[model samples]
Target: MQQGAEYSLDDHGADGTRLVLSGHLTLASIGPFDRAVKAIDGPIHAIDLAGVEEIDTVGAWVVCRAAHRLSSEITGASPEALRLLASVQDIDVDGPMRPPRPPVWERVPLAVGDKVFGARSGIYGVVAFFGQILIGAGSLIRHPRRFPIKALVHQMELVGVTALPIIGLMSFLIGIVIAQQGSVQLEQFGAESLTVNLVGRITLRELGVLMTAIMVAGRSGSAFAAQLGTMRLTEEIDAMRTIGISPVEVLVIPRIVAATFMMVLLGFYASLMAIIGGAVVGDLTLGIPFWTFLARIQEVVPEHDLWVGLIKAPVFGLIVALAGCYHGLQVRGNSEEVGRRTTMAVVSAIFAVIVLDAFFAVFFTEIGWG
Candidate 1:
């Protein structure tokens, strides 16, 4: 068994009190001594540790804490005890254990300022990166031999062809829902036939391209971020740089080009599938023939609607690709950073697509395309 610590207070007339501590001053024996020291109410001029048989960091901490509290100096300490007490004293910070909580009024403005600064930085980074891409494009233009035709083609297959099935299925289901919902609402006015116009105009003008952009952001955008982030983590990007390769030209440019070019086709294909889906619903429930519904769509959906979707497709694709590549290039430190950047890429791309889609809607409406 360990010997418990003991202490005694020795008072001298007009000379102040001396606290004398004895026995094993260790974690297992310091408890009663700690309590006794805290209960001391008289002024202490010194603490004498000559009687301490053994000491550890925990006992040193208790001794230092009491010395600080009583404004007393420690005395008669052996070399080891003195060193331990000095080490503990050095780390004893004179402050609150936790920081004081700020007032709400102060905290709110500080948070807002941080977010604004972060957003400004992000915008600057994106613009600078875009400029780099333009420079790369110019380099390619100057030397057509450096064009990454094979890379572009491979990215096209990855970004466009592989995504067709899921995009098609999603668009088809969306079309069915739109048609079904439109029929229910139009039936109230005995104008169920107008469901054709609703499905045709909405799908071709807005839903087709918008939904496709969101899906592509979630799928291909995340993939781009993850791929680039992994390359950064593995030092492959650094190795390429060391060997005289431009990562932007070899990796980023091809992805951006592939997404931008393929979006036009994907958007168009998605619109077609949605129209087919609407036609299926029309045939199954509204007594309209499938082929007849398809034919009617061409007549009822104005040429401007198709033009609207096509115009937005490439822009949305570019935004998604840029967000992904920007976040990917930002990945650093560890594998967790890759996942974080990938999620940010997808979220930012989708948000940008939607915001731009709203802007397009307003612009197109003002230009008589509404």
Candidate 2:
């Protein structure tokens, strides 16, 4: 039923139920629809949706309810009744469905470029790195008594002594392989006497120290980043600062200092094992007894070779420590951020170590020392 429309019901017609609405089917017209159905005097066995122009959920629901009651009164209702019910099935009472919008980049009001460096994250990273190192050193100097001796010992054990077996095995195996390869080429020229110098200089100046740095970067660097990143994500770094303690002092210095010393130890041990293993290979293939080869090493391997390896230790250590601490502190208080920073720390530290090794190689070569 609609405003300005007439409604009629034919109870005894061929259809047994005939209803008509002759105008627009709006919300305002449902009342007559309700009354006509209610006021009908016979069974209502069918309904029709053909006349509906645009019925809302409420209007649609009224038709459905009338049709249902009518069908119960009779044995079966026309499929028109079911069709009306089906048409409104997708309507939502919560609200009309709106398509989801994609996220848009809206400019934030604040100005980071003006406040910080205009366009220089690399320079900013360098400054922050040096600043954190100074803060760490000063904090240690100021509070020597409160330094984390227990944590230092624990970290030292983790990064140093516990890694000996794998380090020794790797260094020894590498020594054997390098000597075997060198023997094949040197045997052609009867220059196998050079094996001692080769093994000595290569192990001490490059392979030993370089490999040690990579191992430490992969081992200790990830640990430091993950530890501090967890703290950063939990706001424990903020808590330390709030309590008048710098996170660098409480977290970074111990790791940096420990890694510095451990790297030197690794370099020394890796060099020694490599030399010993190379000597074994020399005895087997070059007909040089172990002691004779050792004597040759003393004659040919210069003091500077050892010095180069030792000098690289602290640099590699600092790179690993700084990379780890930097990535850790960059964490933005999320578990995924902690994991990302830890992975970044390991990767960046290894890259820095290798890059610095290349620079060292160039420097030594320029000085006629390589």
The candidate that wins on TM-score is 1
What overall lDDT, based on C-alpha atoms, would model 1 receive against the true structure?
Answer: 0.93
**Tens digit of lDDT per residue, candidate 2, span 1-370?**
3353245554675767755433444467667667766776566655544454555555656655565655622222236544555776445434547866544432232355454564487568769878877977876788789788887787788888987888888899888888889888888998888888889999999999888888888888988888888888788889989998877766787888888888899888999889989999999888999989888888999999999999998899889988888888788847998888889889889888999999999998899877
TM, every model: 0.79, 0.67
The per-prediction tally of clashing pairs is 0, 0
For candidate 1, lDDT tens digit of each residue in 143-215?
Answer: 8899889999999999999999999999999999999999999999999889899999999999999999999
Instruction: Give me the displacement of residue 228 in model 1, in angstroms.
Output: 1.6
Please report the TM-score between candidate 2 and the true structure.
0.67
Q: At residue 236, what lDDT does model 2 achieve?
A: 83
Off by over 4 Å in 1: 1-82, 89-95
**263, model 2: CA deviation in Å?**
0.8
**What lDDT does candidate 1 reach at residue 144?**
85
